[model samples]
Target: MKLENYNVIGVMSGTSLDGVDLAHIQFRIKDKKWDFTILESETIPYDLTWVQTLKTAVDFSQIELEKLNQEYTSLLASIISDFITRHKIENLDAICSHGHTILHQPHNGFTLQIGNLPEIADLVQQTVVCDFRVQDVQLGGQGAPLVPIGDRILFPEYDYCMNLGGFSNVSFEENGTRIAFDISPVNTVLNFYANQFGFDYDDKGQISASGEINEALFNELNNLDFYQQNYPKSLGFEFVKETVLPIIESFEIDITDKMRTFTEHVALQIAQALPNKNGRLLITGGGAYNDFLIERIQFHLPSIQIIIPDNKILEFKEAIIFALLGVLKLRGEINVLSSVTGAETDHSSGNIYQPK
Candidate 1:
């Protein structure tokens, strides 16, 4: 096999709306195995206006969304351009972006991730690979949890790779194929309740630790239909805004109580999702910082050891993996898994746009 290497920037804006994450990565395949180094990375937090706009984008009309898409494409171009300039990164291949998802109702045969337009290549003066989820949705798949392929390639030592992001998802090798799916909502639900208490997030799960878990609320959250669904399923902001919040709001419980009950609910759901009880599980994403939340998860499954990587890996793993996805797309290899997304087949899924 011939040797190849790629230097690219991976950009991601997740459902939590925390910010756009950009990472400069160097990837190489040696002896048919992949290796990577995250060179430079920074997260540009969304401004208040952008945050509010994205938060309400689910209700946007078709025409309004079209307009928003054009504007967001420009926004992404600027962000990617500045990151390259600031890092003085001149040797580059392409920018792989998981553009923010505005709508992801795969069960209805639709998903939208804005900020991926052909013009981004020209504006950033680099090739771009993005819109990674649409093709999977078209193939009768959930079109999410795309990072699992990355987990399999980059961090295969762990028995399971779990991301506690806007939603929680896990991926692992089962038999000869990779199996993965979204487990439940995580920071998406926690941060919302945290914001109610005048904080961006529940630091160290402090608010939840102080409050009491409402048993009724806890039971309802645990019993949600999505939790009972099997693999290849996904959860999105729509599920949170539509199904989750309303259920939580129906009760006249204290805000902290809501937070506590939901935290326990998150732990229980995660514990129940795993198939193994005695293996190392690598945990990453923002919610990994929630000490109390981690404690609860450990409380439920003491046999499974959870490993937290270094800060850079914990923070930029998704960005780094998307960089790998772009390399795979460029190489015409499979980046999205059928086993993970329930697609008709495992396929290379992304759009590549070269600078004009």
Candidate 2:
């Protein structure tokens, strides 16, 4: 049966390794429209043990990855259980999880999001909806930027929805269809450099602002082949490991200079990725807090206005959207867009597991 109202928990762990984000969300459908309110949300930072394991899981053999997946699923269940107990959250209809992205090379006809084991449903004793991207990839799509469906439905006012997470991805309506793609790397690269300086991140982009841009590095970064690709594309950590890191490490420049140049690259790429329209771009995720990066993006595209929402939305928007995706999947409505992902067709995607 189609549910008109649902109380669900949404979970997301981005590639930036920021840790697991969990949101207790309530979704309702009325007058042929859907709406959501985030009741509670929290982020559980991964310990060094899990972090090291996840960061290197891609290098593991198939058997090793399988073992890691089981371990991750156990960790996720415990986290969700703790959240529920701590918040006294009850009546949860489902748990919608994006899991951690370990390998995402969809062009090779496979993408893996661990912690999605079916045992999650049994462990949590709640219906679970997850593994949303595989079907789209199977149908010849990038199997990414799935959040655009939520953008089109929940936050339709903005001309573009830009998420600045591990990477930056933008979604906008063009010629009556929603077009979205990964713009460039952001906090993933920034934080990696920041870690070298004994900081978790370049707080408020201060490190980046304190340095001068290397025109040479900036030019080379702007010339990366990914920038020339058309839409219906996505990025994974593999690209950063193979392409971005090598290019950045090749420079003998100071850490500050590298930060400044890479920050400039991010801002320039984002400015260029946006449609040349005169409207607001709703920016969210961790990068929205980077004042220096935002300044450069604004400097590059003075015509387009950038808007950031409250902290809850900023930190948990993706989690909230994953909740909405699960709701759509339960209703058997289209949640994945072929127009955005280049799939064979628009379809509702996600596995539904009922606890015994």
Candidate 3:
């Protein structure tokens, strides 16, 4: 039977490797419409060893990846258990996890998200809904930017919803269909150079602001093939490792200069993607805190209103949305939109496991 209300835990680990986000959410159907509240949220940072393992997970052989998957599943279960115990959360209808994405090559017909093992349900002693992308990919979609469904339902007032996590992606309604696509690499590229400076991140884009943009590098980056591609497209770490990083590295410049140039590239690309008119662009994720980057984006799109939500919404929106996806799945409602991901059809997509 479909539930009128649900208490769920949403989990997410982005490509930026910031940490695992956990959100205790209460979702309910009020007056025939869905509503939600984030009761609590936290981010659990990965230790150095786990960081290294996830960073190179794509290079692992099948057997190695399988082993790593098991390890990650165990680790994730422990994290979820701790969150529940610490919060004294009870009567959870489900735990919805956007398992850490290790490989996402939709065009090559495969995507792997670890920490989605069925045993997670048994370990956490809760019903689990996870591995949401595989089915969408099987339906011939990009299988990304799934959060847009949440955007449509949760923040219907906004004209655009953009996330600046590992990459920058934007979603909006166009011609009555929800359209979304990745604009450019964000933290994935920024944090890489930040690591060279022995920092996990640039700390509010200060490093980039300290440097100057390289016009030549900016031109080259803005001309990348991905930028020219139409909507319903998405980015993966492989694209960054193979296409983006090499271009940035080939430039003989200081890390700061690269950061500045890339930041400009990001701002320009985002501006170019947006419609040149008045509309609210709701920005979220780690990059929202990057004052310099946000300023640049604002500078480029002066007419459009940019809205950065509160800290919780900024950081945990993706996790919160994943929880909503699970709720929709539980209701047998469509969670994956073909208009956003180029799927064959809109469908509910996820693997559900009952506690053993």
Candidate 4:
């Protein structure tokens, strides 16, 4: 059946290890366009144990990773189930989850998002749509920034949609086709140093604003090979661990100085990444809350109009988009775009598992 309406719980865990984000979203087709209401949403912050586990899972042995996958999937199931029960949700068609990306190297011909096992369906007592990235990589795509398709449909008003999460990515239409790619790391790098200071994050960029930028480090960051690479490229935590961290750590600067420099680096890179042409840019994700970062971005791109949405849309936008992706998959519509992810073709990408 081609249903015109869907009520689904969109779940997500990001590279920054913030927590599981659950959103009960109601999506409807109105006049051949997509409309959505965020019925309810909350970010369930992870405890230290889980945070530590996910932090180091990228380097786990194959067998160890396999075990961790099941473990994490079980946690995901419980989290989703708890969200539904707590919210008294009764009209769910499915649970759409992004799972957590432990390893996202599409160039290496593989990518893995843990907590996407089929068992989650039965455990949560609902149909499941998940593991949305693997198939795209197999098709020779970057298998990332998958939210662009959602941006094209749900946020057609904006000329560009930029997410400032673990990694920053921007999506926009060019010559009638949608284009998007990762520009740089945001919370992923900031949170790492923040943790060293016994803080989960730099609240409102306070710690960073208190320090100074290291010019040499900032210059090297600006000239990195990744920034020179053309579109159809994406980043993962591995990039921070392998390439970015080593370079940053090689300097003997204070942690606060590193944070300050990186924050400045992020602002400049984002401004440089966008086209010189003017347009309304929608900024979301945790980074949008960093006032210092936004100020720097505004300083760099003085003419661009930046939109910071309400808290619901800002935090739950990705979750809502994943829900839309699940609905598209259910309707057999193309949820992954060739222009955005560099896939061979635009196609429906996700695995649907019926509950046992």
Models 1 onward score TM values of 0.99, 0.98, 0.98, 0.99
Task: For model 2, name the residue pairs that clash.
Answer: none
In model 3, the clashing pairs are none
Error of 3 at 257 (Å): 0.4
- Give the per-residue lDDT of model 1 (tens digit) for 1-356: 43388999999998888999999999989877999988999999999899999999999999999999999999999999999998899978889998989999999999999999889899999999999999999999999889999999999899999998899999998897999999899899999988888888999999999989888988888888988887889988989999999999999989999989999998998899988877999999998999999999999999999999999999999999988898999999999999999999999999999998
Q: What would the per-residue lDDT of candidate 3 be over residues 34-135, giving only the tens digit for each residue?
A: 888999999999999999999988899999999999999999999999999999999999999999999999998889999999999999999999999999
Pairs that collide, model 1: none
- Candidate 2: residue 94 lDDT (0-100): 91
lDDT of each: 0.92, 0.92, 0.93, 0.93
lDDT of 4 by residue, 196-295 (tens): 9999989999999988999999999999999999998899999999989899999999998999999999999999889864789999999999999999
lDDT per residue (tens digit) for residues 1-356 in model 2: 57788999999999878889999999888887878888999999999788778878878899998999999999999999999999999989899999999999988999999999999999999999999999999999998989999999999999999999999999988898999999898988999999999887899999999989999999999999999999989999888888998999999999999999999999989888886756898999989999999999899888988899999999999999999999889888999999999999999999999998
Per-residue error at 196 for model 1, in Å?
Answer: 1.3
- lDDT value, residue 327 of candidate 1: 90
The global Cα lDDT (0 to 1) of model 3 is: 0.93
| Best model per lDDT | 3
